[model samples]
Structures are given as C-alpha cells and as structure tokens.
Target: MSATRLTVGWVPLTDVAVLIAAAERGFAAREGLDLVPVREASWANTRDKLVFGHFDAAHMLAPLAVATTLGLGHVALPLVAPFMFNLGGNAVTVSRPLAAALAAHGGLTGDLADAGAALGAVARERLAAGQGPLTFAAVFPFSTHAYQLRLLFLAAGLDPERDVRLVVVPPPFMVDALRRGLVDGFCVGSPWNSVAVDQGVGTILLLGNAIVPRAPEKVLAVPAERAQAPEIAALIRALAAAAAWCATPENRADLAALLAEPRHLDAPAEVVRRTLDGALVIDGAGTVRSDPDFLLLGANRPEPRQADWLADAMVAAGHLPQDAGNAARAVFRADLYDAALAARTRG
Candidate 1:
C-alpha cells in the first residue's frame, strides 16, 4: 500500500543532480521508491553515516568509496557503486590576494602546464621569502578533488605536500573559508567554485578537466550486501534516466530549478545554470570559458579503470601504502552495473 522508503545521504553540490531528479521527478516513485536524501555537511559525514547504517545509499565521491573499501582513510567497509553519477565537474580557485600574487608572477596563463609552472615559481619565491607553503583545501582527503589538485602541482614540478598545505573544507563553506583567509586556494566540485567567483572571494585557476579530463566524480554507493538488493536495479535505472534528463540542454532550466531547492544546493539558478552548461565564469569580472564536457552524466557508468586510476594516484600521493588494485576493482563494481542494466534490458 505504501511506496518503499529508502534513506540516502548527499552533500550540497551540483553533482547531486541525478539523485534529486530521480526523487523529485517521479522516477524513484515510478520505481516504487520513496527516496529520502539526507543532507550532509561533509564527505566524512556521508561516509560515517553510510557505515553506521543511517543511509541505504549515498551520492559519494568516487575515491572515498575505494578508500573506505581499501581501508585507506576509514574503517574497512566494502562499498560498491553500480552507477557513476557524473564526471569532471570540478575547478581550482584562489583567493583574490593569492590570485593577484599568482598573476603578478605569471601564473594566470590559460594553459594548465604553463599556469602550474608559474605557480610553482611563485611558491618557491614565497617559501624563500618565509611565506612558506600556501594552504589549499579539498572536499575530501580521498576524493578526485584532492588527487586533481596534487596532479596540478605535480605537473609544475612542485610537490603538493611541500609547496602547499592541503586541508579539508566543506563545499558549502569553501567561499567563506577562502574569504576568511583560512585557505589560499581550493579544488572543489561545481558550483562551489562558481559560488566563490560569484561572491568575488576567489578567482578560477583551472577546471579539473584540464588536469584529469573526464575524471570520475560522484557515484551511487552502497555497501556490498545492498548491491545485491533486487530494488537496486530499478533504483539505478531511475537514476540513469534522471542523469539523462539532467544532461539535456532543453532541461537545463528545470534541472537548475530542481537543484536550487532550499535544502539542496541552495544557490542561484543562474550560477547553477552556468555550471550545468559548462559556461563557467572564471572570475568576478566575468570571463567565460565554454567547456561542454565539464560534467558527464547520462551514459556515465562506474568504470573500474577510473577506480584503478584514482587508486594509483592515491598511492603515488602517499595516501595509500599499496596499489589497492583488488580493492578498487571490487568497489568499482562495473559487473554490478552490467548485470543490472542487462536485466533491465531483458525485462
């Protein structure tokens, strides 16, 4: 007589689209599901809640899932993602003061490599002048945001750990943190970077796609046993359809409306619109860059190759002791996606 109720967790970010659309647009309802999305303050909160059984699934950072399963940053709990929600929707932003410094030191080049090289030069100069390493924040220790930031520094021949202080800051608070001088720069998913630019607190450095194009972003993550639930297929299908809807240009306005709900991203539809369209306003003065593949949804799947890539980066960044190959493959669960989608096709 009643729809199946399932509680899930998500942070306030642009990539939470599929989940919100699935629930709000009746996709979850058609699947006989009453999806309850619980808002979380941070990725750590989402991970902890999932482990504590407070969530049936979570819109989670891809690497956080692998990290949890591999015991890299949390208690070992093998999670699986049958569906990846989106890919490559992140950016690096620096405070106005730091942006000015970087610009003055030739760090504002549009090229990722040239920019990083110039930033490395500035970092060296600041350190020699006793300013030491600049502080940079990411949403999670084990997220693509972190790895992408490190890779940007790596390309410049500057060690991320030595040239900058890495820290964790929640997405909703990134702009304020940068404004307050808590962090000099941050690598975060949309539309937080847009929010910072809109607020005039930070200047966009580079989109994450410049560092790792098509980098895996969020996934629909659940514990190992939950992956086997019969309802997972319908749920994932609904989300996949929702992702397709979000990817449509005609639906951008509506999609932005869905995400701009008071309890969801809670930001301006215009800002959300820019992020969805990849027409990013890189600075407060309104410079725009059109990046069509800034975020991939719709046909996005949980690829083990993505997991393996992130795992290798984690090890290289000294976040993991070993390769975590097996753990990554297990958690990625492309097999589950194949099975679920196949069953849906058969039906």
Candidate 2:
C-alpha cells in the first residue's frame, strides 16, 4: 500500500523542529506517512492556509488555536491540537537605540520585573517628552508573544493598550523592521531574535520564559472534524517519535543543520544550533545567555489545562470576553494523543 501523504503548514522557527524532523529523519515514513512540511512566512498565513484546507495540519500558536475554535478573530473553524510542538522559544529584542534608552533608565538587570519597570520608565519619559509611544512587534495578536508583551507592560505598571503600541510583524521581517526603525523592539521566536542580534540591529531584552515560564508555544493543530481520522492518529504517532528524537541532545546538532536548509528556516545553522541548545547570542557584543528550559521539545501531549490557560490569557488580554465559556478548552485533544501513543506501543 502507498504511504499516506499529509501536508502540514509551519512558520520558520526552531519550535518547528518536530515537524521538520519527522519529515527529514524518516519518522513519518516509518509510520507509512509522507509528511510534506510547507514553510510559511507569518502566523496568519499559516492559520489561514490551514483553515482553508490547504494544509492537513499546522504548527500553530496555542492561543490562536483556541481563538480560532472560539471564533474570536476570524471565521469559526473547529480546530483541535493533539500534540504540542514546544514550550518557551521566544524572546524580546529591542533596537540598538531602544537598548541604549533602556540602559539609561536602569538597565535590564536580569529580572523581568526590574526590566519592565525600566521599560515603563523609558516609555513614560518618551511620552512626557512629546515623543510617540515605543512600538513593539509580535508575530500575531493571538499568540503567546503578545501576551508576554502584555505581561511585561503590566509588570512595569504600564497599560499595554495606552502606554505603548503593539503591532504584528511577520517573524522573518522582524529584523528588517527593527533596522528600519519601524519598530522599537519585538517579541519573536528563535533564529529571528538571533538573526537580529547577528545583524547588530537589536539586543535581546528577555527570553519568553522570563514572562511566562514553560508556556506552551506551538501545537500540531488539525481540523476538529478530522481529529479522529486514522491518518491523523498515524501522524500523531510519527510526531511523537520525531519529538523524542529531537529532544535528545546528541541529535540537536544534526537537527539544527536540517532546520537551516533553504526549504525550512533558511537561517544559519550556528544560530539554529544555539537556539536548540538554549545558548543564544543576545547582542552584537557576543553576550551569550544559556537557559536549559528556553525551548523544550519532547513528547508533549496536548492538555486541557494548557487550553484553559491560553483562554484565560486571552480574556486577561481583552481578546476574549469573560462570558466566552470553556468551549475553547475542548480544542486540545489529549485523549487522541494518548490513544495514538498507546496504539504505537501496541503495534
């Protein structure tokens, strides 16, 4: 019999490692699946393509999945996440001038609260001096990155809505946006932040974990109606196997090289490697910050609490109404994940 072919959409980021590994390392083939991973430039494109049936599944933002299922921003499409791609793989980067301004205020201080206070001070100074608010970019409105930024602002005693401006910039375009002075800073996933740092246009202000420790970042989201399909189960099994492979420290170097291919992230292997290892280059001055929990990828099954957490965050950020109910929490199909892995073991 021929292998089952499935098209999966993804944005170019280190968290897409599992999907890339499954396609490149023969894990999908082992399960009679031919996984075609399509690289997208932005989270919106990925979500739209997936919802429009251009993709069988997608590497999607956890909050976006929740929001989509709840029919918040776009058309109400039932989406379900059976597998989690990763946790905590994002950072905040500020333009060189913004970094200087932050330093003058009080410095980063390696503390999120202290850093937020300093940022609030700078934003206030800018406003008091008749300057516009500092604009920050995030990948998408319904993303952890945006929520993290909100948390940073709240920590600094500033209103995310009124004190500063937040805009959506495609991850790949963040470096250019910073360099061109279109944005003062941005919160984005790996390789992009490193890319900005490498170009000497930005300095890393804080890792995503600093704002929300071990927050669920991306997931393998499929149409809710197709959640029970045999192919989806097989794909889940393949992804589980691939994610385990990606978690092994010995396999990361090869994985990083694979992710750096033109068809994937099309970034430098060293930068991808650094991101996978949680040893990121933060600035042009060669400041390397290492955090083992920076980006975790390994057999992460979707859980209901994670969905609830995202929904709560959406409400907190005013993206979702308080009466939105808990329907979104059902979008995470942990039962499907459990069954798929169990079937794999039985086989």
Candidate maximizing TM-score: 2
User: Which residue pairs show backbone clashes in model 1?
Assistant: none
TM-score of each: 0.97, 0.98
Model 1 lDDT tens row, 1-347:
58888888999999899899999988888777888989998999999999989899999998888888777756888899899999889999999888888788677765688678777888888899998798899998888999988888887778876778899998899999999999999999999999999988999999888888899889888999878887787788778778888888999999998898788989999999999998999887789977898877775677768878877887887776684566677788778878877876887
Over 1-347, each residue of candidate 2 has an lDDT whose tens digit, in order, gives 99999999999898999998999899999999989999888888998998888999999999899888877779878999999999889999999988888888675655798789889889999999999899999999999999999999898888899989999999989999999999999999998999999988999999888889888899999999999999999999999999999999999889999999888888999999999999988878898888999999984988777777788888999888898747656888899999999998898
Off by over 4 Å in 2: none
Per-residue lDDT, model 2, residue 104, is: 83
Candidate 2's displacement at residue 312, Å, is 1.4
Q: Model 2, poorest ten-residue lDDT window?
A: 102-111
Model 2: C-alpha RMSD to truth? 1.1
Ten contiguous residues minimizing lDDT sum, candidate 1:
320-329
